[model samples]
Target: MIRLFITRHGQTEWNLEKRFQGSKDSLLTELGEKQAGMLRDRLASQNFDLIYSSHLQRAYRTAEIIKDNREIKIIKDKALSEMKLGDWEGLKYDDVIEKYSKEYDLFWNKPHLFETTSGEGYSELKKRVIGSLKRIIRENDEKNILIVTHTIVIKQIMAYFEKRPLEKLWDLPYIHPTSLSLIEIDDEKTNVKLHGDISHLENNVKEIC
Candidate 1:
């Protein structure tokens, strides 16, 4: 059996500003750091055999905080990075909606039909994210693993485990910054123990944007 503890990075400056941070990078806000500390406390007792994080600074920083003094090795991988937004990177939500109305609409409402000229679409994102996940599972069969990645990456991972179709990508249970999810895999069976859980944040569960 393999236990995977997956989490999204802490809230970033772009996240607070409602900007698209795809492929781009941003620093974690004060609240973001606090959230990571809280997560650290929440999982302090658990032991992780290995930690995999997105090469992006935001996710890597979050992983560092959660790892906190632990001796676990953190491996950064581009496959765990956020969906590349290309021209949409570093742009505000409304601006992207205004500048690329059709594509933006398709991105949010019809992700399965969404396509991008400069960046990757949902299908492309899913392929890489899921492929990385499978690779991790294959390499570490009976160990506890921690993966720190982006929102879309985590969502795609959860959707894969839930057997959800691309059309229902944004179903329910929003993936908040620093949220923790757990998946238990044994042989051919996969079980999701938690999805988009913010219990670690306790009363400080207000969404920034």
Candidate 2:
């Protein structure tokens, strides 16, 4: 059996402002750095065999902070990145809602067929994420793995494990930055033990400001 511990990168300036950071590289804020420190302290006791992170700076920096001197094999993958929002990458929620109402509604309200002008659809994102996960599962015999990625990817991973409908992916709980999710994987059984755990940054979860 392989236990997977997944976390979204720490909060960023965009996260603070509730902006769409899809596929765009952004740096973690000061609070985000503090969150990473808190996570490192919280997860110090756990043993991880392999550490995988998104290629984005936020994710890589988060992994670097968490794995400080641990000497674990860390792998970077673009397949685990946040869903690209195309032209909406850095736009604020309210602005996107007002300017691109149709597309925004279709994305947040009905995700099945929503596609941005230059970004990937939810279906395609799911495919790529699951494809990467399958490869990881097949490559490793049995071990604990840590993956640092984005909220959307985390949601899709959990959705895949629960065999839930793709359209209802957003029906799951919200994913906070620096939060930890646990999954148990094996040949016959895939279990989501925990989802969007931000107990490490309990006070900061709502204080993204």
Candidate 3:
């Protein structure tokens, strides 16, 4: 069996401002850094064979903090990064709601029909993420791995493994920043032992689910 501990990157300045990050980058807020520290504390006793992180700074930084000065080389993969939001990368939530209401609605309400004028489609995002996951798992045998990525990436992965319909993408729970989820993979099957865990935060941050 292989134990995969998947987590979202910590909060960022854009997150606080309720802006879309997409492929854009931002610094972690103080709370975001602390959240990563808390995650390190939570998993201090656990042993991991390897750590994989998205190419984004937020995810890489979170992984570094979790390693806590320990000498572990984190593998960076673009496939693990957040879904590119294109023109919406830096837009505020309220603005996107007002201007791109139809697209945003499809994103959350009917993901199968979701596509962006400038961003990546949900189908492409899911394919890349799932493909990356499969390759990672295939390369290792009976190892514990930690993957630090983004909200959309993690949610799509969980939804895929859980055998949910693509049209019901919102059926997946809100993926809290720095939240952890465990997926157990074996020769026969895969199991989602936990999904979107943020109890360690203890109100240090506010997020849906």
Highest-TM-score candidate: 1
lDDT, candidate 3, equals 0.88
Which of 2 and 3 is ahead in lDDT? 3
Task: Give the higher-TM-score candidate: 1 or 2.
Answer: 1
Task: Return whichever of 1 and 2 wins on lDDT.
Answer: 1
lDDT of 3 by residue, 145-169 (tens): 9999998898888888888888877
lDDT tens digits, residue span 1-209, model 1 = 99999999998999999999999999999988988899999999999999999999999999999999999999999999999999999999999989999999888788988988899888889889999999999999899999999888988999999999999888888898898899999999998999989898957654743
Worst 10 residues of 2 by lDDT: 200-209
Q: For candidate 3, which ten residues in a row score worst on lDDT? A: 200-209
How many pairs in model 3 have backbone atoms within 3 A of each other, for residues 3 or more apart or on separate chains, i.e. clashes? 0
Question: Model 2 clash pairs?
Answer: none
Candidate 1 vs. true structure, TM-score: 0.97
TM-score of each: 0.97, 0.94, 0.96
Cα RMSD to the true fold for all candidates: 1.0, 1.5, 1.3
Residue-by-residue lDDT tens digits, candidate 2, 18-88: 88999997789998888888889899999989999999999999999999899898899999989988888
Clashing pairs in 3: none
Q: What RMSD value applies to candidate 3?
A: 1.3
Q: List the residue pairs that clash in candidate 1.
A: none
